[model samples]
Target: MMIYLTLFLEFFKIGLFAIGGGLAAIPFIQELSKNYGWITQEQILDMIAVSESTPGPIGVNAATFAGNTTAGIFGGIIATIGVIAPSIIIILIIAHYFAKFSETSIVKSAFSGIRPAVTGLIATVGFEVARTTLLNMEKYNKATNNLLSILDIKAIILFCAIIYLLNKYKKHPILYLVAAAFVGVIFKY
Candidate 1:
């Protein structure tokens, strides 16, 4: 069907340009959510959470989840492949050329230029996620004047607590994730 084709192509393009990681793919996913009405901002946040908690990579998991929601099992398969195809192809190409030009200045310069751009993309996704997660966009939309009222105090407190714990212990991340989950359930967030 046309929907499946569109999903594949759209996610393929996302995979092609999402140079950093799953976080970097968030902007593309958000755009698709807007462009196709395939998902909501709230669903995007949920997808991020579910994807992070699951076994696989977040971007692939997101593509699969969205595709399944849109169509069905086949859509999930196609979208997952679409999002990873470019990475597979690019890795092959890079592997082929890397041995021959491992010391070339041009290649080094290309990677040097790419690293910061990837970092910027990842940072953009972080801001976007934070904006959605820590702010009450529904309240903001109803009345834009009261910025203070639009902040989600509980999420902010939990975020700060997690940061503090991470800084203090620097332990495994799963501990923090479990703690957050427990807090969310307890607070009914």
Candidate 2:
């Protein structure tokens, strides 16, 4: 149907320009969600968490989740294909020319330029995610847009705890994630 077609085209555009990786695609996905009213900002965060916890690439996982939510199984299939098509094409093209261009200064310069831009994109996404995670937007809006009142103490404490644990122990991330989940459930944060 038309919905499936639209899903494919939209995700195709996302995959085409989503350089760096899945985190880099967050902004584009946010735009897509906003433009289409396909999902809420909170849902996007949930999708990111689920995608990260799952085995597949975050962008692909997000596309499939969005497509499924929008339509059905067929939509998931089509959207996933659409999202990955560009990567396949680009990889093929790069594989064909990489050996020839690997030593060229122009290619090296281009990659060097891209590296920082990608890092910035990822950092931007991280900032956005942290802002959403640590703040209560609804409370802010309800409290006449007071910034201080919007700060979620539980979230901030949890965030600090996670950071402290990460710095102190340097243990596997899953342990931290599990501990956070347990805290969230117990405190209802």
Candidate 3:
């Protein structure tokens, strides 16, 4: 009822605004902490980890995860519908307009202008994802709020090793993800 509607609207907004993809949506979902009180940053990270490890689009996975977090399976369904609605609507609208304006110079110029805007959006999303994953120290610092040095060293070495292994081997991405998780656990970092 109300819950589903809210879920739909919120996720619809998320889908509409989070242009770059699921990873880009992370920051906005983080902002949900300010109002929803439903999920936390650590949970968001865990959701991302699980989503990346699973099938389908990352954005879809995230919506499912967030929905499940809010109200179990029902919530998940509502959220997923919300996430997809905007794309569906936009595609339909664009299809109609594109057919009508396919040959217009004004339409061509508008598209040319939109291309750069989309590029900028995508680039910004990439930067934000990098900032979250790469810029932060590996773990929380107890006293100074800085990253724990040992944890960081482990992450750096692991990152390099994973990169090298990826370049050397053409294994499935899932294998790399599994290997990274295993290495993280065995190394206890």
The top-ranked prediction according to TM-score is 1
Off by over 4 Å in 3: 104-189
Q: What TM-score would you give candidate 1 relative to the actual structure?
A: 0.59
How much lDDT does each candidate structure score?
A: 0.90, 0.87, 0.83
The CA lDDT at 15 in model 2 is 93
Candidate 3 TM-score over all chains jointly: 0.56
lDDT of 1 by residue, 80-149 (tens): 9999999999999989989889779998899899999989999998999999999987776544587788
lDDT of 2 by residue, 30-136 (tens): 89888998878888888889889887888899999878877789988888998999999998999889988978999999989999999999999999999898888
lDDT of 2: 0.87
**Descending-TM-score candidate ranking:** 1, 2, 3
Candidate closest to the true structure, highest lDDT: 1
User: Cα lDDT of model 1 overall?
Assistant: 0.90
Output the lDDT of residue 175, model 2. 91
